[model samples]
Target: MKKKVWLSIKGKQQTQDQEAEIIELLTEGELYNKDKSQYILYKESEVSGMEGTTTTVKIEGDQVTIIRLGTTNSHLVFKKGKKKYNRYETPYGDLLMSISTKNVDVEYNEEKDPIAIHLDYNMEIDGAHGSRNTLDIQVKH
Candidate 1:
């Protein structure tokens, strides 16, 4: 079933908080359960500067992965208390980035499917502390 998705992100750095939000249709989304793990697939529209890009999110077990492809290419993996590194490709160039997840919270629907996800993490780029971040995703059928 297709659903409406609302995403909100907040970043805190140097005592300042910056927030951004997007509300869009979920192009492709599904939830799967197997063994002791659950998986989610979510895709959304291309954004402004990210012209040809498609944003895809996958959640499995306690890890969340986000990928952007087309105009820009990047992969980010967030696992609680673990730091993961990756390179972000942009029009300008490539950027080295690291993400350390602090917490992950999930809310489920009556069907045992995920209806919301909340993540708290810290990010660093090129070895410098970037921001503490919070991302919330909610879906409605």
Candidate 2:
């Protein structure tokens, strides 16, 4: 049962001594539940700098997965106290990416569907340390 939804996605990234960089996007997406997991799907617009791309987010307990297709391609996973690896593909080049998750917090609705999610992690790209990052997503009716 997929339902239309509005998403507020916010992210912040900070290097060792650099100022935190932030991005916020408000977009319409679809939401559904299946196989004990919840999914959110949306298309990336030019404002997000990934036009023509579609993003899907899956949430199950404290683990979250984000997949992107089209202009960019990537599979990123986040689980508290775990490190996940993947390749991020782009027109320029593909990079080896790794995510070390420090925390995952989720807020759920009465139906056990997630209404909000927050993740804290560190990222490495091409074997080089990148940034300490946070991603927050809020779902609106």
Candidate 3:
């Protein structure tokens, strides 16, 4: 069964020569579980610069993957102590992005649903030093 859920996201990005940039968002989405994996489906907001895109977050064990489609397309995977790369396509152009994951923390509710997830990773864009980023997300029923 699919459940309606609310998502609260807090993101921080720190890059060399720049102070930390923080982004916070609150949105509603659908959450479901299948094959022992949890999935969240949500629409991208204009504030995120991808108004027409749909975003899906998949969580399985210690790995997390985010896939975005529509106005922009990208697939990113985060696994602790591992690195993954992908291409991000936007209206402007396509950019190469990589994520070197530092940590993945997930907290679950008594019902076996995820209540919170935190990710710490270093991101590189276009082969340039990008930023150290952290994403803290809280899922609410």
Candidate 4:
């Protein structure tokens, strides 16, 4: 089945335009799947004036690994980081965001709506100073 995932980031100190830009970045990328029923969707955004990158990688496996890194450009700034973006977060105090919607313990709920995968994201604006944000997402099949 084809899957579509949506991501959104919100913060108190972020501007409306910045929020929109983040959303755009999240939805701009495509989900990567190495096997059927298992996939990964990654999204990232940079806070203007803030030198950092935030990336989210949704892995379908039971255990997911999140790594944060530091980058000088946006998520799409280059093609090399595109795939590795999920493995590490840029050192820019960016949070690695991801959600696993595949539940094997319970049967699929056909009547219920897709659940929103919420992730707490924290990033440092400067060395020690930073802000906290929430990433709300939904994965649909």
Best by lDDT: 3
RMSD of 3: 0.9
Count of backbone collisions within predicted model 3: 0
Q: For residues 1-141, write the lDDT of model 4, one tens digit per residue.
A: 434655443423342335422432234423444553333344444443333543444344332333323463333211111222222234444444322222212112364323344444333332333344444444443
Question: What is the lDDT of every predicted structure here?
Answer: 0.68, 0.92, 0.93, 0.36
Q: lDDT for model 3, on a 0 to 1 scale? A: 0.93
List where candidate 1 sits over 4 angstroms from the true fold.
1-48
Per-residue lDDT tens digits for candidate 1, residues 1-141, read 433444433233331354533333434455555555555544434433466676666677788787888878999888888999999999899999988889987787897667787888888889874777777666554
Summarize candidate 3's per-residue lDDT along 21-72 as a digit string, tens digits.
Answer: 8988899999999999999889989777789999999999999999999999
CA RMSD, predictions in order? 4.3, 1.0, 0.9, 10.2
> Which candidate, 3 or 4, has the higher lDDT?
3
Q: Give lDDT for model 2.
A: 0.92
Where does candidate 3 stray beyond 4 Å?
A: none
Q: Report the number of clashing residue pairs per model.
A: 0, 0, 0, 8
Which candidate do you rate higher for TM-score, 1 or 4?
A: 1
Q: Sorted on TM-score, highest at the top, how do the candidates line up?
A: 3, 2, 1, 4
TM-score of each: 0.71, 0.96, 0.96, 0.35
